[model samples]
Target: MEMQVWASLFGVILGGLLSYLAQFTTVRLAARNEEKRQAAQRAEARRSERLELLREFIAITQAGIRIAEERDQAPDWDAAGTPEWFAAARNIIDRLWVAERMIEVLFSPQMYQLARAYASAVDHVLWRLPEQIAAEGSMWDHLRGPQHEFLAGARTDVGSLP
Candidate 1:
């Protein structure tokens, strides 16, 4: 009878230990799942932010291209140095600088380099307008190559995101 009581007590302790282990393992698995879900959410948020930044950069670059085109086609080169022209050019450049910095921070080195090339092309066309006009030459042709390359790189970069 005494041996039976001892066996029952041992069984109760063993059962409680097994129950505790099961609960512990379940809690750990739940925590791991929560972490995985949060990580996915963070990744998605980052992708969205990157896409928005890319869009803003593209728009600013397009604005610069339009300005360059306008300067190229203008009959009066004298207007290139006007305050209005300066303000417009400066605004684009300022925006480009901000976008470029953000790209550098958020993108790969190759992407940042592509952005730099495009920004440089825009800068060349905008700042060299007077010289090009005086020489009866156009940098509009030069801007197109860099613009195309940057756009292609950007598209590829975005497409490759998972």
Candidate 2:
């Protein structure tokens, strides 16, 4: 009877230890999975934010390019200095300044540099419009290289996200 009691006690103890280990492992795995899920959510949120920022910045840049193109095509250089023209140009520059600052804050150093170059190219063209000096080609040509470089950099930056 004593032997029977000892054997039963050993079996019960071993079973309880195994049950505890299983529960511990399950809880750890669940916690790890939760952490991974939350990390993925955060990454996705960041990617979305970057995409919106790029979209807004690109739209503003295009608007600036259009204004520069119109100025380039204008026949009357005197009209370029009108208050209305200055107001429009000022508005574009203000928006571009904001966009540039946002890019500088949110993006990598290389991305910010690329954005700055593109913005500067556009600004140069706009400022040159009032002088009536024709470049060898369209003023938009000045923006093409910097725009392409910035776009490529943006694509790379966005695509690298998880």
Candidate 3:
């Protein structure tokens, strides 16, 4: 073959290889970026779910105290009629039940675990409050006591959302 023809063939082959490699690298990088973006979106969704659970848990605990106070022996203004705490508890539970369904929509096992922990803490507070009331003991103090470290459980793995 002529030298010029050989040179032309070599140049064309090299250009083709370079083009293919460039496209391959670009596609790979784009795929990687897409994956990272998806992961970040999933993480944000989970954090949102976790924060919702925390809000409900806190609301329930705070409101349960108020509901009980409505039936208190003393009528401190803080103990006035219409137990806000009781209402708060019921409201939080109602909101949380919906949040639980939302967690399924977002579908992250880790987030679900955090949410479940919050639910458990709130449930414990709700369940134990009546007993503490019957015993004429402070429920807040009861929470601080060795009630299987309920407070600690409440503190575990809570994710905050901005």
Each prediction's whole-model lDDT (CA) = 0.86, 0.87, 0.58
User: Positional deviation of 2 in candidate 1, in angstroms?
Assistant: 2.2
TM-score of every candidate relative to the true structure: 0.89, 0.87, 0.60
Point out where model 2 deviates above 4 Å: 135-137
Q: How many backbone clashes does candidate 3 have?
A: 1
Candidate 3 per-residue lDDT, tens place, 111-154, comes to 55555554554445554534555684654554444323434443
lDDT of 1 by residue, 1-162 (tens): 999999999999999999999999999999999999999999889899999999999999889878877877777876656788789989999999899999999999999999999999888777774666558465757777888888899899899875
lDDT of 2 at 151: 99
Clash count (model 2, backbone only):
0
Q: What TM-score number comes out for model 1?
A: 0.89
Clashing pairs in 2: none
